[model samples]
Target chain A: METVVQQLLNAAQLGAVYALIALGYSMVYGVIRLINFAHGDIFMVGGFAGLLLALRFTWMPLWALMPLAMLLTALLGVAIERVAYRRLRQAQRMSLVITALGVGIFLENLVRLGVGPETRQIPSRMPTTPVAWLQDALGVSVTWDKLLIIFVSLALMALLWAVVHRTLLGTAMRAVADDKDVVPLMGVNLNRVIAVTFAIGSALAAAGGVFFGQAYSLDPYMGIDLGWKAFIAAVIGGIGSIEGAVLGSFLLAGVEVLTVAYLSSNLKNGIAFGLLILLLLIWPSGLLGRPASKKV
Target chain B: MSLLRLEQVSVAYGAIRALHGVDLEVREGEIVSLLGANGAGKSTILRAVSRMLPLQGGDILLGGRSVRATPAHELVALGVAHVPEGRGIFPSLTVQENLALATWTRRERRHVEEATRRVFRLFPRLAERRTQAGGTLSGGEQQMLAVGRALMTGCRLLLLDEPSMGLSPLLVREVFRAFQEINAEGTTLLLVEQNAHMALKIAHRGCVLENGRIVLEGPAAELAGHPRVREAYLGEAGASSPPCPGTPGSSR
Candidate 1:
């Protein structure tokens, strides 16, 4: 019973990370209609930024590290957009896709050049002492690390919801997604909105990176596999929907974790993609997207 | 004084010119009709005035100042509201949200309050569907919503392209009557229409465009009585058409 509870808790933690990274992928895709292939590298950059913050700013509390890291990561995102995505805004989708792939490669190489290619650890700043909680109403022991991860994940998602639904920028972002050509008609510069999208998406990816570094040791190539996984999560959720991405991430994360635990031990990533393919066969627009409308 | 003027304005798409060197004017508080057949460049004139289309060789003056290079959204601040071809209403937004977007730059919350009241007064059907998505509105209702959305911009120069298009005869008359009311309230209007007879009836002055050039220009009553205009637009036989030059537009 304890093992089952522990397994469920593990799945939830991994799911939380997937959800964060997936949101970034989905958001950037929603506005630009591009997959932002560099998004996983964005995660790596964020994780590194968080590590720098932790190492450099020892005075700041552990909780403050997230907001600070988000700020830095958002700035990095805007810079990346200005350099990489800006020129290709009106280019063909394939061109943008290749550009994004270039960005990801550049980011991985840059990280390798900046820091050695060895596995790195984020020095734990917070208490890691396990606090136990009841699971499944069966009084099974569930650890604090899992609960903490879940709590932070929910809080971040809630914050994201508020930013998306309540703010002027959010409205502008949704407007961009709906019709980019009409944005200037609404007195909004499309470039600025696109920049903001990159900023927000990258910032979120960074937060995911930070949490990931804390939970597991970081590597220069950490973003590559995680990034692909998150992209799959975004696809399964519906690439343009916030709720769909989150829900899809949780489902995908659960499938992967449980497959490793109970099913074929080495077929973890394989099972996730298999689920994605099944979803595509059934509903190609993903679980939440509106069906495509034909122009008369 | 004229609030808007087109001084030999010309527009081209690729190598194809849609508007030839055409001179036109709109007074500060009058209804001016641009009467044409489809492809006569009537919509192009409105597009030029709104700065949606670039002028190939001439100047569009708004209140005596050249507006050839002014951006589209800036014209809204200058009191030019363009109800573009196909309405261009945001389909995802609700009626109220569309109206709010029109007034996004407005101050005097009271003015917005008053505008909302006035819009509801003008379009009660719109009020009935204020919360509904714009895509679901019927053709006539969408026109009303389009007009209502334009009104929220506090524009003085209202450029309407084919307001009477796709509406029923009854709704058409109702839409024209609403324009009459709007004109009475002191907004300048540039009305573009393919239905020349209806257009001439409401216009203080009318310009007849053929193949991208203004072939005739005068008071609406005079142009309405012109033999060629009467022959082509009223679907009656002209002097060139028959034994009588005086036979056309005598009914108007």
Candidate 2:
């Protein structure tokens, strides 16, 4: 029973990180229908940005460090849009997809050259003594680190939901998603809305990067695999729907955790793609994606 | 001064020329109708004014300021609201949200509120179904919502492209009546339509376009009675004797 409970906690922590990365994928797809294959590289960029900030300001609070990294990463996302995606707005979808892969490669190699390819551990800012205290009090191994991660992730999701549903910028985002040409007729600038979407998505990815760095060591190639897994999470949840991304992340996380705990440790990483293929075969639109409608 | 003036404006869709030096003018507080058949380039002229399609030659002046370099969205702030063909209503948005989006470029909240109230008064059916999704509205209601959204921008000029398309005759009449009411409240209108009869009925001046050039232009009554316009546009074989050769509108 304790083993099952511990695995559940682990799944929740892992799922939160995946959800943050998946949101970046889902949001960019939602507004522009771009797969943003380079999003995982943005996550790596955020992790590196956070690591540099941590090194420069060793006395800075985690709260300050996280947001500063997120801000810089968001700016990087906007720069990517301006320099790379802007000219290709009217290009074919296939061309955009190919360009995205090129961007992913560009970001990965750029970081490898600048920072070297060595894996680096982020100094732990969170106290681990709480895990012992909680385990002693509850007679079950409940860690404060996992709980804090889950709490922060849920809070960010709630904030994002409010901004998307209640704000004017959110409405503009949805309007552009529905019809890009007609949105300009309403006096909403298409490029600005798209840039804002990229910024927000990248910021979320940065937050995920910071959290992931705290839990696991960072390497230039780390985002390549984790980013793909989060993308699978976004797809399983329905690529364009925000709620579906979070739900899919948790679901994939649960599957992997359970597989490692009971089924086989060897099957841990393979479970995400395996489940995605099975779910897609049964429900092609993902779990919560709106069914494709005919264009009028 | 004219509210909008198109001087020697030309447009091409790749290899095919859509408009050939189309010269037109809309004076402030006047309804000027551009009447034509399907390929007459009536929609193309409106697209040029809205800055949707780039002009290959000539210039469009809105309130004496040239709009040739302006982007499409900036035209709305410059007091030109275009209701493009097929009612460019954002279907997934609610009727109220659609109206709200029109006020996006407006700087003052008080002005936006005032404009929104005016639109609701102009079309009360929109108010009754304000919360409903725009897609779910009936054909007539969607047309009203489209025009209402244009009004929300507090525009000095309204450019409509085939507003009567696909609407029932009764709804068509209703929409035309709303156009008159909106114009009476001090907004200038430039209407593009294949329905020459209805368009002429409401317009003060009318121009006929055939094969991308203006073939006739005069007061609405004069164009309505012009022999070539009558035959080609109104689809009528006239029994009345033709007007005298030197009559006011005949020579041009």
Identify the candidate with maximal lDDT.
2
DockQ of all candidate complexes: 0.30, 0.64
- Candidate 2 deviant stretches above 4 angstroms: A131-138, B238-252
Indicate the residue-level lDDT of B126 in model 2. Answer: 94
Give the residue spans of candidate 1 off by over 4 A: A132-145, B238-252
Top DockQ prediction, candidate number:
2
Candidate 2 displacement at residue A265 in angstroms: 2.7
Error of 2 at B77 (Å): 1.1
- Candidate 2: lDDT of A203? 94
- In candidate 1, what are the lDDT values of residues A172-286, reduced to their tens digit? 6776776665555544456887898888888888878888888887777889999999999989988888998899988998898889889887899878989999998998989
Worst 10 residues of 2 chain B by lDDT: B243-252
TM-score of each: 0.89, 0.94
Cα deviation of B157, candidate 1, in Å: 2.3
